[model samples]
Target: MKKFTITRILMLLGLFLISSGIHSTNKESIFDNIFTVMERTSSAGNLPGIIDNAGANRGAGFNGRYVFVASRQSGDYVYYWDVTNPDAPVQELNISGIGGGTFTLADLTAIGNHVFASNMVMPGIFKIYHWNGIGAQPSVLIEYDSGTARLGDAFTVMGDPDDFAMIIVSQHGGKSFYVWAMENGELNFDEPLVVTIDDLPANANFSRVTLPDGEDEFPVVSGPAGVFVLGEDEDIILTIEQSFFPGWPMYVNIFAYEGGRYFAFMHVKDNPAANVMYVLDITEGEDVLEALQILKNGTFAAKVLHSHDMGSIANGNASVSMDVVIDSFGNLWLMGFAAGNGFVVQRIGDAGPDGLLLPFMETFDGEGEDTPDTWLPEGWISFTLDDDGEEFNWYWSPGPSANPNGQMRSQSAYQDDGTWYVLNPDNWLVTPQIYMSEISGDEIIELSFKIGTGAQTPGFK
Candidate 1:
């Protein structure tokens, strides 16, 4: 056509690209949108402390602006962070000496102001701590010493508004549940409220707990690798165990209470060879019934592969083992450990039935980055979004660029004055945008992209 310089044509195309990207400009403000998470943690330096290798810890919320985290670096101690500010989480206090002689690294639980933590050891020591609203350090609330008793590994603590909180030990030398009571962090009950396979709806094949040689007992007392509590209801307890039992089978069991009968999903382990995970459901009563056959699911449980095998990856290493939390809007956000994998924030609650995922509140790596690299390894990271209750659509950069699909849409996402907010698009009728609201609000801000859409699509698949 007419004589147009390359620069002029490129400018026109750029403007058109920007214009086409703008769908609409209409806007609306809908408040009362809140999200919930289960567990979250990060390396040292995320919080304020002279302690090197101190990581960010997260769990269910408590009080006003504090969170219960499974502290990583410091003997897996539990610490409270003031998240009222959301971004700059400052350490309010710390709890230590929960039983193990060495560094305690495991899960933690909290109800109201009270907290609990555990580590791997025979007759392991389960420690408790309490935060009293006012300025008080989290002191040792209680310590449940497993002593020489075959202790459960990877233990988790859960409590209700009532008096007792159940400590679900994945490997209690047998199929059993330890129930403990807390009178402001003090263990009120003496022994665990033992729920085993023998007397319930079924019988647990604890043969793995005993060695084949017969000389030594293969006590099911290996530590619970992980734990999850489905609300405060006495309905069901989701426990994940990592033990040498049954040939070191990593298990995921769901002990559900229905009517008066207890149904269980027993003995799940990840197969290294096939890169797959096998899960089974069992029931308790006169005999331990294997309800479901071995169901094979994705083998992403192993962080080594999940973080490395896929292009877009998620790392839920909150030290709590895949802590999946369903939010108020029914979005499931998992907070645990995310190392070199930046795709975690992108997926958020993408696993639910309706293409929705839980919203991530915060993520960080202690000690600022040494280099300004756009990756997960070098820096501390965290994110919070205004989810409109819609299954957020994943958007890539420029055109067809590869980026992890996140939970929400954006109208404007500029970094100004350090505050991130969504703004109405330039021309779209209902356009939305996000930008930094306050520069000093969130400590670590990360933005990344991937290549594809839908769960079946392949970018991080």
Candidate 2:
């Protein structure tokens, strides 16, 4: 009496795939709502919801039941959503006064009852707000300012007391704001603990990132707090890619208390050459953290899994500066803000060297997870040269297409920030970097791809 349709069955199968932690990875339609979750994996059925705010979405935080978002609107406000039923989330509150006194949120993060947000003003001020949970009125609990800190970023809530947060001052051309921690709900007129990098007693501006073996050397003196210094000589290591590399991602874990010790993960961010994960052991107590010791067996932080394109503008993004959360079930979820870096969830195996990831290929074990091949490997990149030979720079759009469907299909970079990198109408739209990697014994190789001008316009290459 009933006919089962293949399309219907596939839709159900797609949803099931998400529950298994492997969602869609389509980047054809920007802001088209391909995902209902943070991972934004593509799906024909799973459409995402968008909240309208001019400019860019700075930061977002999830406290189990509510999704607090900070997209600088006309005023300083933090939007909270009732995600009790994620299927139909409703904006329950628009708590303004985030960065009170004409300042707006530059970034935000939250856990349990506390939500933290900061502004990019000269003094570098951050405010914390607390709520009684579902459908409750939120109020400013505490506000702090570091007069010397600038480019305040990665405002993550350290769950030790569930009340404090660590702010990374990403100031450039400066010695950089070091490791600042705040806990009490009040401010002290005296200076807070500012970790000064330029003045380290060792006069050590740089060090080998991976212990005892790594060779790549990057500037460590200036920029953001990617490296968590442990001992006197910067000997033992736990750090993300330093901020000197513009747009390079830096993800650090909230200090976790495990086996009578505090630990967090850092990113060396190398593959095929060095270990990507660096496990850290912070000293006990929040106020005083000694030099961390690298745990050779701590493999949880080294699992390298790739997500779909972050869709950042200008292809300026090499890393997705994600926020790390290691769940109780031994699952690690790296969450991204609404801006760039889509969320990626991975189940880490034993605590040593790349741990027990489900290896899809033999060549990539204890190294990193293998990325699945895509139809268009070398994605689009936008390029333009003026008559005088000058190149066009980066420009963000409201949406690459008609509306903000959140897709960046044809740009050289996987940019879905709504900004189209426009070149001279007849110049060029270069593709991503591509080079031959191998020659088989037969010395015969074939390349295949699909391309269309989408127009019959002359000189449209």
Note the Cα lDDT for every prediction shown: 0.31, 0.35
The Cα error of candidate 2 at residue 364, in Å, is 50
lDDT per residue (tens digit) for residues 1-461 in model 2: 43222122223323112111112332222113222333331222222234232133455666543566665555455666543233444453546444452346555666666565555444555444555453456666545664544444433433232443333334423444433344453322223344345443332211111111010111122112334433333332334334422222234343322222222232323232111222233232222122222232233234222333332222121222234444444433334432422222222222322333221110111111222311222233334333443434432222334224433432232234754343212223334333444557888543222223341222221
Candidate 2 lDDT trough over 10 residues, lowest sum: 359-368
lDDT string for model 1 (1-461, tens) is: 54332123223433112111112111111011222222132222132342223233322223322454454544444545543234544453444234453335444444455454454455556554445542455555445676654443344444332444444554434554444444434556566554343322222221112110111111122122322222112222332233322222322322221111111112222332111112222221222111111111212132111111111122222222222233344332322222221111111222432443322232222122231222221112222232342322322112223235433222233344855543322211111233334557558644432322221222121
Per-structure clash totals for the candidates? 84, 22
lDDT of 1: 0.31
